[model samples]
Target: MAERYAISSGSAYEEKYGYARAVVDGDRVHVSGTTGFDYATMTISDDVAEQAEQCLRTIDAALTEAGGSIADVVRVRYLLPDGADFEACAPVLSRWFGAVRPAATMMVVGLLDPRMKIEIEAEARLTR
Candidate 1:
């Protein structure tokens, strides 16, 4: 079995939830559902597009720390409470993933925090 490594974004929730933001085992890195809240400032934007961008930023940071890049992502999952909000986030999603074109799934689901407009999770394989 490969050794497991945990990555942290220093978000308060990680401590409360008892889970790392991302984890690495061998060549693959699995990032947990990331939200729009900026962990550093603990602030979340009301705009869905902005929230989507923040989700990608948080995911990318975790991937980078795990020795991968957004380009290495093989899968992505998006969660939004409102189905209509999906359209608002398409451009932001495209901005980060338009070229990579990883396998993706988007669904309408209620998040733990009502202030959260979007949540994103990703998986990446390290490439040397």
Candidate 2:
């Protein structure tokens, strides 16, 4: 069996919700739906664009710990309560994903917190 490892962002929700921020199985890394909340400060920005940037930052850290980077991302999912906010985040998304060109999906859905404007999840396969 392949080794399974879990990574934490030190978000209280990870402990309260009983889910890891990311999990690595073999060479694959699965990142959870990450919000804008900075784990270190436990603070979030009201602007959707700022939130989107923060989400990617968190995901990148998790991927790096799993021996990978954003370029290794093969799949990505974007969730937001307001579809309109998606446009504001497009540039931030493109900055991180443009060259990598991962399979992607976007959905408008309610989040656990009303303050959360967006959530992102990603899957990556280690190439090195």
Candidate 3:
């Protein structure tokens, strides 16, 4: 059996929700839906684009700790409550994923907090 590991962002919600920021099982890393809040400051921005950037920053940290890089990402998911916000976030998304070009999906759905304009999740296979 493959060994499993968990990484934490130290977000309050992780304890409240009983989850880790990301989990590594064998060579694969699965990142949880990450919001815009900077876990260190517990602050989030109102602008969706800024929020999108923060999400990637948070995910990147998790990925690096899990022994993977953004380039190793095989899949990504974007979640937002407003469809119009997608366009605002596109440039940030493209900046991160343009070269890697992972399988991607976007969905407009209610988030756990209204202030959270966006949430992102990702999956990566560690490079051998």
Candidate 4:
């Protein structure tokens, strides 16, 4: 079996929910569903585009802590409560993923919090 470990972002939810921000097994890192909340302040934006930006930022930090970067992301999933909200965030998503161009999927689903406009989950293979 490959050696594995967990990485945390110090989000309050981690302790309350008992889940790591990311898990590294061998050279693969799986990041959990990350939202747009500014973990430090626990605030979220109402705008979907702005929220998408924060989601990538959070995922990037987790990937970095796992010894990889967003460019290493191989798969990504975008979750939103409204399908119409996705277009407004397309440019933001392209900005973060244009070059890496990971396999992707987008789905409309109700999130845990109504304030959350977007949630992103990613998987990466370390090249570092």
Candidate 5:
């Protein structure tokens, strides 16, 4: 079996820690938890909706690089700093997942970064 690892742009996986953004094995790609931080500015949006959008954008980029697309996603996990933000960000999430309705879970938790109110993680399979 061949194994491969990847680190997406704007990610500090190797520098901050020592992990790849995604690891590929066989037909599966396990993407790491992705946050909505603008790589260009190294800043995170204060709004939950914008943050969610940014998180999905980052996840999409990782999926694309891993020989997968949003359609190939099997599951998604969302972490929100406040439970109240769920409704505020749900519409954005629905729009992003309108076509690909993968299994999903959203929860409220204290995040590693205080300014970050949302983080998203996903798993996808390589198709063809």
Candidate 6:
């Protein structure tokens, strides 16, 4: 069986929840749902576009640690607290993913944290 590995960057969630930010098994890397908070301050921005940018930054770090890159991403799932914010945030997301164009889904849902406007999760493959 292929070995499994977990990666983290000492974020509070990993320390408090006892979970790695991401796990890699075989060729697949599964990243946890990431919010738009700056870890240094544990603060989330109110602007939807800024929040989306923060989420993608975190995802990028997680992917890099898992030996993958954004280009290797095969899927992305976005959760937005308000449906109306989709248009406001879509351009930001598209700018980040313009070149890669991975499979993606976006949905409006009630977030666990009321202050959070967006959350992002991703899956990537490490090619041989």
Evaluate model 3: give its TM-score.
0.98
| Candidate number of the best lDDT | 2
Whose TM-score is greatest here? 2
The residue-by-residue lDDT of candidate 1 on 1-128, one tens digit each, is 88789999999999999999999999999999999999999999999999999989999999999888999999999999998999999999898999999999999999999999899999998995
Tens digit per residue, CA lDDT, model 2, 1-128: 98799999999999999999999999999999999999899999999999999999999999998889999999999999999999999999999999999999999999999999999999999988
Ranking by TM-score: 2, 3, 1, 4, 5, 6
Clashes of 3: 0
> Which of 1 and 5 is the better model by lDDT?
1
Native-to-model Cα distance after best TM-score fit, residue 33 in candidate 6, in Å: 0.6
Candidate 1 wrong stretches, greater than 4 Å: none
TM-score of candidate 5 relative to the true fold:
0.91
Q: Tens digits of per-residue lDDT for model 5 on 10-111? A: 676435866666777767878777777876578888898999898888878878887788888889999888889889888998998888999999888888
Order of the predicted models by lDDT, top scorer first: 2, 3, 1, 4, 6, 5
lDDT of each model, Cα atoms only? 0.94, 0.97, 0.95, 0.94, 0.81, 0.86
Model 6: weakest 10-residue lDDT segment is 8-17
With a 3 Å backbone cut-off (N, CA, C), the pairs that clash in candidate 3 are: none
Q: Candidate 6, 96: how far from true, in Å? A: 1.6
Candidate 6 differs from the real structure by a C-alpha RMSD in angstroms, to one decimal, of: 1.5
Per residue, candidate 3 scores C-alpha lDDT tens digits across 1-128 of 99798999999999998999999999999999999999998999999999999999999999999878899999999999999999999899999999999999999999988999999999999995
Off by over 4 Å in 6: none
**TM-score for each candidate, following the candidate numbering:** 0.97, 0.98, 0.98, 0.97, 0.91, 0.90
Give the poorly placed runs of model 2, Cα more than 4 Å off.
none
